[model samples]
Target: MPAKVGAVKVNNVGNSSVFNIGDVYSMSPESTAKTYAGGGSFITGDGIRIRLGQSTTYVTDKDKLDQNIT
Candidate 1:
């Protein structure tokens, strides 16, 4: 038996992927997490408070974007 798909709609796809009806031979996935924050509370005067935001860099391999699968 084979997979039967109807009215398939792909909205968005990101990073390296193997989207199809088949089996994958090999795949290497890597992922990591790092956070940085200022030691302070969410209490401030009636004004815009300056705070440091957390961010992460996406992994890339030469040209293609590596899929950081967990």
Candidate 2:
């Protein structure tokens, strides 16, 4: 059996490249990994943003996937 823990946030922007998940997350516009379409905005309560036209690829690759073994 596997127990679910924590939460994940997915960004559906077009070209943005910012993804954040967990209890507490924060990012500044100047230090953002990629540039957003219109502008970067924070997600309510989650303290994350993916910009206007960015998309999330959090776990699309197997080599970079984060697996939990308990």
Candidate 3:
């Protein structure tokens, strides 16, 4: 599974990320490709980086969808 950035803290994303404590970010699945939100920057623990609120970014699509269908 890919790294699913969810309702997690920015600091938790990367041990040394600029994402401050209490900074909530919108996360998207691997399918959509990009995942960022309203104007922010985040760095992964391993250095993978992404910026929030950038056009063409997929972070704006933050909504709980049901993947498990009966």
Residue-level lDDT of model 3, residues 1-70, one tens digit each, is 3354557533345433344334346633333233444433443477565554445545343665535333
Shift in Å, residue 30, candidate 3: 24
Tell me the lDDT of candidate 3: 0.44
Clashing pairs for predicted structure model 3, backbone only? 36-59
Per-candidate TM-score against the hidden true structure: 0.27, 0.18, 0.14
The residue-level lDDT of candidate 1 at 32 comes to: 55
Candidate that scores best on lDDT: 1
Ranking by TM-score: 1, 2, 3
lDDT of 3 at 64: 59
Better of 1 and 2 by TM-score: 1
- Cα error, residue 67 of model 3, in Å, equals 6.8
CA RMSD of each candidate after superposition: 9.7, 17.6, 17.6
Q: Runs in model 3 with CA error above 4 Å?
A: 1-45, 54-70
